[model samples]
Target: MNVMPLGEKLLIKRIEAEGKTAGGIVLPDSAKEKPREGKIIAVGSGKLLKSGERAKFQVKKGERVLFSSYGGTEVKIDGEEYLLMSEDDILAVIE
Candidate 1:
């Protein structure tokens, strides 16, 4: 990727929203919610530690992760939407 995150930041590409529900009902454009999940596109080196060292990040590139619904900055790169968030903003990694 052209853009690299800085200091514990992560660059994620949001996953597509579901087109239909489990009940076989198609969701309209307005009914669809923004997805809270995404794949890690890029990551920063690490966060600074008090010991004059850099702490390594727990998450790596290409992992599917769940983030806060309202967290992160939405950005567009080459017409594609992505999220720029801190490592702490990521709630969990999908197994």
Candidate 2:
């Protein structure tokens, strides 16, 4: 947790994808699709505007958020997986 995302960026850990089918069939790893939902680990300070001011980020750390499946860049931190994406990439925050 030593790394912090730069401006307007977020560090998130993807939630585990479902491992079972609705019909009670267990799905293997290869059959599971990558999850688009995740918990925000850390967030950047803010977006720098042309006016030389910083706009606060709407999403906060510990929030569960939804993003495009192909949006973020995957990174490994000390063998743990995380996604780094811009704030605009987030679709919604799960309440």
Candidate 3:
């Protein structure tokens, strides 16, 4: 991919969940929940502090993370969908 992530941002691809309810019911298109889980594909270098120092990002590439459903901008690269968001938008890293 030619696109590069910058400035403490992340490039993430959302994980596809089972599109069904627990009662063996297949949910409609609109009934699907917003997936909060995803795998991080790329991470920014670091954040620049006010004192001219860079604060490194904690999340790394290939790490699984949980993010807010309302966060991020959807982008398509090379026919693949991805979410571009700041590191702060990530809720937590999934173990």
Candidate 4:
């Protein structure tokens, strides 16, 4: 399914966290933490400014990014998990 975010929103796919610890202990699903890293799946047009000019986005589709842990609404598309959030919720674009 195709998705388009409106007005500075972004669609992201979370990067899976490792299932094992450095000690070789395998972690169960219950012990896993939701990953804060994700890849941009889709991006909205720039935010609208008071002057009617659109603000440019610092990130783009296909870019890997870091976001606040509690940010974004969870969504499922075609059985896959995704995140929808505002650009302000993004902490940084991973280089």
User: How many steric clashes between backbone atoms does each model show?
Assistant: 0, 0, 0, 0
- Which regions of candidate 2 are displaced past 4 Å? none
Ranking of models by TM-score: 2, 4, 1, 3
Summarize candidate 1's per-residue lDDT along 3-92 as a digit string, tens digits.
989998999999999999999999998999999999999999899999978889889999999999988999999999999999999999
lDDT (tens digit, per residue) of candidate 4 on 1-95: 89999998999999999999999999999999999999999999889999998899999999999999999999999999999999999999898
In model 4, residue pairs whose N, Cα or C atoms come closer than 3 Å (at least 3 residues apart or on different chains), thus clashing, are none
- The lDDT of each candidate is 0.93, 0.95, 0.89, 0.96
Candidate 3's C-alpha runs over 4 A off are: none
Q: TM-score per candidate, in order? A: 0.94, 0.97, 0.91, 0.96
Question: How many Å off is the CA of 71 in candidate 1?
Answer: 1.3
| Regions of model 4 farther than 4 Å from truth | none
Worst 10 residues of 1 by lDDT: 1-10
Q: Candidate 1 at residue 85, lDDT?
A: 93
User: Model 2 over residues 44-69: C-alpha lDDT tens digits?
Assistant: 88999999998999999999999997
Clashes, model 1 = 0
Winner on TM-score (3 vs 4): 4
True-structure lDDT of candidate 4: 0.96
